[model samples]
Target: MLTVQPLQPATFPVPGQFYMLQAGASYDPLLKRPFSYLSAENGSITFLYRIRGKGTRAIAALREKETISLIGPLGNAYPVPSGEFIAVAGGIGIASLFSLFGAATGRATLFWGGRTAGELLMTETVRGLVRTAVITTDDGSAGRKSLVTEPFREYLAVNAHLPVYVCGSTPMMKAVAALCSDAGARCFVSLEAYMACGVGACLGCVVKIRDSENHEGRFRSVCKDGPVFDASTVVWEGQ
Candidate 1:
């Protein structure tokens, strides 16, 4: 996790919007990596990333005063609905919802989960923004010993009027969407895709979205059209 004070364009970052970052000063790695803003306050922005590859390893090697290039506030942001909010996050997907938590007052509730307690990052910061927060882990190392969906289901039963917002693995988002559908609630999902251009030109990060006029549906670029979308608009793998 790194937070930096950007030299220009200090404002207008919303939740779910991402930036392409390149930590290296040389062209050795050659491509920038995309990360959603974990939090942006005053003039500084934070990014939460796991050290999973060479690009990240290169990022880890940065020293103070070293330069980093970024192309950003890219992609669409999560919609702010009128009613209460139920946020569902899996693993580092919490990055997509933290800003929303900060913007909201008493209307948001976050359900965050991970493989273990260690992966559940920024719990204290998130807890300060929402009305209620529920944490779960697969191994029962924290909060509850069940999937986030379990508590989400329970919350949905009593508060079906609220809107649900999710950012996580594909299967988890799909499951949350289905659960919302079954409960007659509105749901929004933020997708994670392998984006090359961060813009629509490359045709690299397309996802199937329903076309009301054409039952067969169509493909939309996650970077250009959205990374955040109405759950009902997404055409899941089988359907």
Candidate 2:
């Protein structure tokens, strides 16, 4: 976890938006990595990231007051739906949900999961924010000893009127989308893609979208068109 004071507060990032953060000061790790704005307050923004690679390891080694370059609040953000809101997150994907949960306030319910209890990051803050919180760990180390989708399925089975927002692995999001489709509930998914450039110029991260008018699928940049998209609008079969 890291919090940074932006050079300017006028353009702070909103939930679901990301910034390109360079891991180190050296040119060895040339490209900047994209990280979602975890939470923002008092003119500072927080980021949640695990040390999975060189880029992340570099980010982990930083000390206080260290300067790093950033590109900024890039990509589309999640829309605030009306009525009930359900949020689902897997592993480190929880990075994008804090602000959303805060915004939704009493209207939002969060279902978060990880491989084990220890992996469920920011448990205290998450529990304190949402109206309802459901935690799951695959190894039974905390909360329920089942997939978060299990509780999610149980919830949606009864409350088919609510909308769901998810951020996680592609397969997990796809599965949730399928569940929402069967229940006729609205769903939005934030995708994680390997992006070379935070902007759209690289054309590195793309997903196939289902076009209703053409009845065909078209490719769109995840970094530009969206990291957040309506589940029904995504073409999961071919991807």
Candidate 3:
């Protein structure tokens, strides 16, 4: 919702792509985290992040006019949904899934989960684009006192044919994928791994690939090859 400049392709972003930010002393390196593009337009990239640890908190304090260096718009996007779609997110993962709204221009719903109402992000931003935008707060502070996957499953029960997209912490993404697999719905999941470099050469973001059928071919770099991946391609240890 905050705009710093007019939209430009170089500055705008595509879904599933990410940026490596330089957070100068206004922040501690320990507090600068990589973020994926939410929705980019008018020479601006929109981002939604929770102010959890110090890094993100520092990012929240930055002034708009201040500029930062970033390297990205990397990784392939989830297969665009054809008919209808559902997106499930936890915490600020909406920053990762919100961009898919345009690609899912088909029809859609969003199921978001948070520890409390205060942690919710992108509800209005996404609701403005999709048909159903549901927010579930764990402390009963917002929409429903439930995890995001609850509504995700309930919605899928009735809309079994819908495609699902999910993003969040590792545990949440794993759970959503498991649910989608059980219901026979195709799913896509965005990942989060520690990264120092946002490109493949560093080999810093390796993840275990989980699904046998989908991961048939090879290994992928979250920074270069991903951050976004098919649910069936991740090997989640459930940590």
Candidate 4:
């Protein structure tokens, strides 16, 4: 977890929106990395990220008062659910969905899963905010040993009318989207892509989306058109 306070008052990012962060003044890493806002309040923004590669390693090395460049509150936000909704998060993907709990107040339920207990950051914080939170770990170190989708599928069998919000690994989102489609529920997904430009200019971060009218597929820029999209509209891999 890293928190940054801008020198000037900052715009609070809507849930599911992300920022492109470039650590330090050097351009050795070249492209900025995208991270969804964990929370934004009182001119301070927080991001939850794992040190997976060079970009993240740079971010991890920053000291207090060091300067970094940021370009966002970018991409679309998840729709505010008017009724009860379920959120499915895989590992650190919870970073994007946490604010939705506040948006829905007592009407949200969260199904969160990680490969191990260590990947499940802020579990207690999430439990405090949602109506109910079901946790699962692949290793069975905490919660159930089953995939997070298992309990979500079971829940939908009973509460099929509720909408779903999802953010996770690509495979997890695709799986959850399939389940929602089968249950006749609406599902929104937050996508991750490599971005050369955080804005739309570079055309580097595109995903296939199926046209609603003709069913033809077209590429859309994830940086601008979404990081958040309706699950049914996305042309998942192998589709």
Model 3 over residues 1-239: C-alpha lDDT tens digits? 32334333474566777776554465366423578777777567766655657666556667878665566666667777777788888887887777678776586788888899877865676689888888898899999888888888888888778888888878888898898888888888888888877777778788766455565445678877787787876777743
Candidate 1 wrongly placed segments (more than 4 Å) = none
Best by lDDT: 4
> lDDT tens digits, residues 1-239, model 1?
88877987656588789998888767767778889998888788889988888788887888876778888889898887555789999989988888887665547888888989999887887787778889999999999999999999999988888888999999899999999999998899999888888988999889988877866668999988889999988988887
lDDT per residue for candidate 2 within 71-170, as digits (tens), equals 8889988897655689999988888877887666446788898889878888998888777889999999999999889999999999878889999888
lDDT, ranked from best to worst: 4, 1, 2, 3
TM-scores of all predicted structures: 0.94, 0.95, 0.86, 0.96
Cα error, candidate 2, residue 152 (Å): 0.8
The local distance difference test score of each candidate is 0.86, 0.86, 0.74, 0.90
Q: What is the C-alpha RMSD of each candidate to the true structure, in Å?
A: 1.5, 1.5, 3.0, 1.2
Model 4, span 1-239: residue lDDT tens: 78998876667788889999988777779889999989887779999999998888888999998877888889999998987889999999999998888876447889999999999998999999888999999999989998999999999998878989999999999999999999999999999899988888999989899886657678899999999999999999999
List candidate 3 segments past 4 Å from native: 1-11, 25-27, 30-32, 210-218
Q: Which is the winner by TM-score between candidate 1 and candidate 2? A: 2
For candidate 1, the per-residue lDDT at 234 reads 93
- Candidate 2 global TM-score: 0.95
What is candidate 4's local distance difference test score?
A: 0.90
